[model samples]
Target chain A: GQQVMQIPQYQHVQEGEDFTTYCNSSTTLSNIQWYKQRPGGHPVFLIQLVKSGEVKKQKRLTFQFGEAKKNSSLHITATQTTDVGTYFCAGFDAGNNRKLIWGLGTSLAVNP
Target chain B: SQTIHQWPATLVQPVGSPLSLECTVEGTSNPNLYWYRQAAGRGLQLLFYSVGIGQISSEVPQNLSASRPQDRQFILSSKKLLLSDSGFYLCAWSTESYNEQFFGPGTRLTVL
Candidate 1:
């Protein structure tokens, strides 16, 4: 089974601050997907990075897949209160029925 | 827009009680389904996944089980619950050709 480890288990920032979370996997992933879960809410899909070194952005959120395909990052710029939540990175290891290995996640707290 | 539904938005049960949570997908067919659990202050953990009806796969050995009775319906059940089972349970679905998984509103379960 593949394992993905995420760094900075928690983050707190001012409304106009920037934040980022990193995820690393033990094996190369077929693809990586990012998700955000607001407090007391379910996880929601944010974006996916398939190609090596791929980068995608949604409004103020940026996602990046490491060139090695074994790591990824999510960066949020000029964060707001609405950005408070746990950000998780999931990677699929096609080897075992294509099961997903998810990062524990970074819980973000934005102060207004 | 596609919608995924989970019932009993919140539940409270006692030890040894039976547990059941249902999840269903709409606007999609034969999509991959997944069951995950998130403990407070923790990342999401994969419990089970299915690629098709009656093709359930367990990610971890636990007190819970899952079944897919229909093309779009997935169920998570436990005959006897444990205090450790208290957490937020989430269901998700995705296409076979893609890696982005869309999650349903989670069920908050508390074992009292």
Candidate 2:
């Protein structure tokens, strides 16, 4: 099984501030996907990065994949109260190909 | 449009009781299904996944097991629930190509 480590288990920022979380894997990844789970809600897919050094943006959210495909990051600009939740990054291990290696996640709290 | 469903939005069970959680995806065929658990203040953990009917894969060894009786149905079961089993359980489905996964509303289980 592959392991993905996430940094800064939790963060708290004022509304309109910025937040970022990083996901790192020890091995190369076939693809990486990001998800967000609101308080007391299910997780929703945010984005997926397949190509190395790929960068994608959705509204105020930005996703980046490392050049080596073993790391990824999600950056939220001008966060809002709606952004308060847990953000998780899951990686598909090139070795296993079937199982997704999940990061511990970074829980964000936005204060107005 | 596709949707994923999970029943009993929340559950409270005594330790040692049997447990069964159902997950279903609509409007898709031959989808890849997955089961994940998120504990308090922790990240998402992959539990099981299925690629097709009657094909299931367990990512971790625990008191829980999973089954895919139909192409779009995935179920998680346990002979006896443990206190540690309490958490948020999520079911997700992705296309056969293994891209982003859409998650269900989730079920919060509390074992005492």
| Residue range A8-95, candidate 1, lDDT tens digits | 9999999999999999999888898888888888888888888999999889988999898989999999999999999998888756
- Residue A78: error of model 2 in Å? 1.8
* Interface RMSD over true interface Cα atoms for each candidate: 2.0, 1.5
lDDT of each: 0.90, 0.90
Q: What is the TM-score of each candidate against the true structure?
A: 0.95, 0.94
Error of 1 at B76 (Å): 0.9
How far does residue A4 in candidate 2 sit from its true spot (Å)?
A: 1.0
Clashing residue pairs, backbone N/CA/C < 3 A, model 2: none
lDDT of 1 by residue, B1-112 (tens): 6899999899999999999999999998899999999888898888998999899989789999999999999999999999999999999998973568888988999998
- List, residue by residue over B1-112, the lDDT tens digit for candidate 2: 9989998799999999999999998998899999989887777888998888898888788999999988889999999999999999989998853588888998999999
Task: Specify the poorest-scoring 10-residue window by lDDT in model 1 chain A.
Answer: A92-101
Candidate 2 residue runs with Cα over 4 Å from true position? none
lDDT by residue for model 2 over A18-38, one digit each (tens)? 999999999999999998988
lDDT of model number 2: 0.90
